[model samples]
Target: MKQLIFSLSFCLLAMSSLFAQGIQFESGSWADVKAKAKAQNKPIFVDAYAVWCGPCKWMSANSFTDASVGELYNSGFISYKFDMEKGEGPAFAQQQSIRAYPTLLFFSPDGELLKKAEGARDAEGLISLAKPYLKANNNANQEQTTTDNNWESLNAKAWEYYETKSNRSDLSKALKWANTSIEMNRNWYNLDTKAHLLAKLDRNKEALELAVDAILAAQDAGELAEAEETMELLRKLRNN
Candidate 1:
């Protein structure tokens, strides 16, 4: 009976180890990390934790090590682990308004803060928390054929998915978003984003027209950065 129980325990231990596929965190200075995320057009996932926190350790050992959680987060965002008490973590934590251990923060590529969830959770729980953000990520380009496409929802989704578009279809969706956004509000941001998306998708003729128009309008509106950036985009597109 004793031998049989020992054998069962060993098997269980091995099974547990097999299932624990730990997450891999990227290493770099905070600025470089953010820049890389922006360049890749991916959202940032920060696992804000402290070394002394038991829940933090538990998550690192269990939740974060789960294969399901690792797969979901790895594909969905550029993940980082920050020790809230160490290095640049303190100031960042303060800025992010983190007062507890194991705060999961998601940020858009444009440095806009999206969600901040506090406390530790299992793999399923964590993924559930991140689900909406993930949907928003892809749906930004999804064809909005339904009357349900309100301007606030559309614009919010566009901002969330802006740089994080995955493929050519997404790029096309971004064009749709840009056009729809112009219909809703022909303001500088919408126009500028539309022109930028056009240039990115190599839809040159319209891109050039819109880019020039945007540059002129932005300059007239005294938005120098938008004007200059759009001008540079126009130049780049023309050269390419």
Candidate 2:
């Protein structure tokens, strides 16, 4: 009878530990996090959010519920959800330089900041962003090489040449820069930049093609505003 009782007790303890290990959003004092993180040797993921942001709500409702996200987060992180306008949450947000709602900050077990991301990211995007930071040796050199390039900078430079050059003289340089931006990050903004440059060079047909691609990609990513705007611009350009 003593042996059987010990086995049952051990099983219950194991089950309890497994349950505690699952992905859960905790709301509490930052002090509470310090001990838990030390005990688990896991990083903390802080969601700095505000009540008034629609995208923040959408991320909480849709992105946070994703199965893969839940699995990865459960196993890999200690998660906290903070309301940026209330409680100690606001103070923490300010300390972390969180100027935007729905900012996500990742910190190492020792409380060193690993990465910070702002804006609404879907499940896949969030997973992609989190994977690199969870590495065993999360060094700055490894991070610098993996970080996404600033496509906007390249696009802005290309646009400057397109606007100033006479007789379409620098169109080739504009096209090259725009293409490089797209290759670096194939997001709606970069695609639109490429389309605009093509249109300026009087390559209306090519512009229309790139615009359509951008519209479809944005729509598929659930960026309705960008998709609609790009589609409308493409229609108008094709008509003219």
The best candidate in terms of lDDT: 1
Q: Model 1: runs farther than 4 Å from truth?
A: 1-20, 141-240
> Which 10-residue window of candidate 2 scores lowest in summed lDDT?
136-145
Q: How many backbone clashes are present in model 1?
A: 0
Question: What tens digits encode model 1's per-residue C-alpha lDDT throughout 1-240?
Answer: 999999999998865554456566779877887898768767778899999999999998888888888777777778799988989999998898899998998876545567889999987888898777677666642446542466655655554556787445456555666677778867666666777776666568878888877877787788867467778878987887
Error of 2 at 160 (Å): 45
Where does candidate 1 clash, by residue pair?
none
Winner by TM-score: 1
Clashes (backbone N, CA, C under 3 Å), per candidate, total 0, 0
Q: Global lDDT for candidate 1?
A: 0.75
Clash pairs for candidate 2? none
lDDT of 2 by residue, 125-154 (tens): 888977875663233224334434577777
Q: Estimate each model's TM-score.
A: 0.55, 0.49
For model 2, the stretches where C-alpha displacement exceeds 4 angstroms are 1-22, 137-240
